[model samples]
Target: MYYIENVDRKLFIYTIKDVYRLEASMQEIEKMTADTDLVRISRTCIINTDHLKEIKQVKNSRLEAVLDNGEMLIVSRKYLQDIKKVFRRDLS
Candidate 1:
């Protein structure tokens, strides 16, 4: 299960898949529920566009999503397009 660290405590978000293996893992559902503009970068992580403080481009066209919580997550190259699409969809 994934655990999101909120101001008061950590919230548990579970899944049947191995994606929830890490206690600090960030799930797409959690992000999506918090913000519709969030995108699934991989099987393990999701990012909230509304909460994105910065986006750094790295090697191989990969990206790093810096959240307002000061957490950084690497976005896989494979999901880059999907991420953009999700944000666009949220605008419409």
Candidate 2:
């Protein structure tokens, strides 16, 4: 499972089959899942690396993470270095 913050700043829990609002701040959720597969890819998104399908370079030198469910999430440059470390590959 993973969590994403919507435009309204409400947290939502995402599963392979469903997504439901989870009343928690991103910071709180991050802390709760710190030791798990979840990683912060962007200010609005936290994903389970275990569910990652691929990582690709996109325009503006940003990276895109493709999840197993076919959802593509942007990985901001701010977190690019961290992602490279996790994947053990050079993203540049």
Candidate 3:
């Protein structure tokens, strides 16, 4: 999966070319994928780091993840350190 997003209380899974509805909460999915490449980047988004191309800083202090498919997702302040540890790359 490329990413999972929760919008308006519903969850959708995005892949390279298609999207599917998933019948599970974010917490549950996170727990199940804890040992995998999937990592929660925001309250509404959990991304597959294996599909990540790069992450960069945008305006302000926000971090943005760019996927291999050329999609972008915001990395929130609350999960900055968590994401950094996963990639272990310099954020400067």
Candidate 4:
């Protein structure tokens, strides 16, 4: 189970396997977005890592992720810590 943002309405919804269900509060949605598969790119956007196509180095210490659905999201410096965790280091 996971949750993602609705591309059109910007609503946060829960994803059960292959189904998507709408309706959740801000605090609840924030926790769900903190999962490894989902990353918050901005105050208003959260993307699913599983759907990510590519991570591109953008200007100003930012990363741009292109998703399977043709949506591009920018990972700002504010969320850099979370970003690094998603792409964990081997350290071996």
Candidate 5:
């Protein structure tokens, strides 16, 4: 899976060429994929770190996660440290 997102209380799984609806909540998916490369970037989105390309700083102290597919996702301040820790771990 590339990324899983919760929109309007529904989960959507996005892949390279398709998107699928999942009968699950973000919390449930997180627990199930805790051991995987997936990391939550926002309240409604969890992305596969393996597919993450680069992180860039944006206006207003916010950050943006650029994916390999060229899609960008905003990284909220609340989860900034968590995402940083994940990348730090990956590098080491």
Candidate 6:
């Protein structure tokens, strides 16, 4: 599962089959899910690294994470280092 904050500022829990509303902030979810597969990829998105399918360089030094479910999410340059660390840890 993954957690994302929509444009309406509402949190949603995304699963492979469904999306349910979550009544929690992204920060709270991030902390609680820390040490797990969840990794913050941007200000509004926290993805399950286990679900990551591909990381592609999109231009301007930004990246795009394609999830197993075929969802593509942006990885802003600000969070690039952190995402790289996740990949390194996984690879190691």
Clashing pairs in 3: none
Clashing pairs in 5: none
RMSD each, Å: 8.7, 4.0, 3.6, 4.6, 1.6, 2.0
Where model 1 places Cα greater than 4 Å from the true spot, the runs are 1-35, 59-62
Instruction: Give TM-scores for every candidate, taking all chains together and pairing residue i with residue i.
Output: 0.52, 0.79, 0.86, 0.57, 0.86, 0.82
* Superior by TM-score: candidate 4 or candidate 6: 6
Give the whole-model CA lDDT for all candidates, comma-separated: 0.57, 0.76, 0.87, 0.60, 0.86, 0.80
Decide which is better by lDDT, 4 or 5: 5
Q: For candidate 1, lDDT tens digit of each residue in 1-92?
A: 22233222333333224322234434435544544565666555555566767768876577787766676777677887876776778778
In model 4, the runs with Cα more than 4 Å from the true position are: 1-3, 6-21, 33-36, 59-62, 89-92
Q: What's the C-alpha lDDT at position 4 in model 2? A: 67
- Runs of candidate 3 with Cα error greater than 4 angstroms are 88-92
Of 1 and 5, which scores higher on lDDT? 5
**Residue 92 lDDT (model 6):** 77
Best by lDDT: 3
* Residue-by-residue lDDT tens digits, candidate 3, 1-92: 89999999899999888999999999999989876778899999999988989888886677899999899999987887777666664333
Whichever of 2 and 3 has more lDDT, that candidate is 3
Tell me the lDDT of model 1 at 79: 80
- Model 3 collision count: 0
Model 6 agreement with the true structure over 1-92: per-residue lDDT tens digits: 74465547898878867888988888898889766667888889888888889888876566888988788998877877777777777777
**What ranking emerges by lDDT with the best candidate at the front?**
3, 5, 6, 2, 4, 1
Backbone clashes in each candidate structure, one number apiece? 0, 0, 0, 0, 0, 0
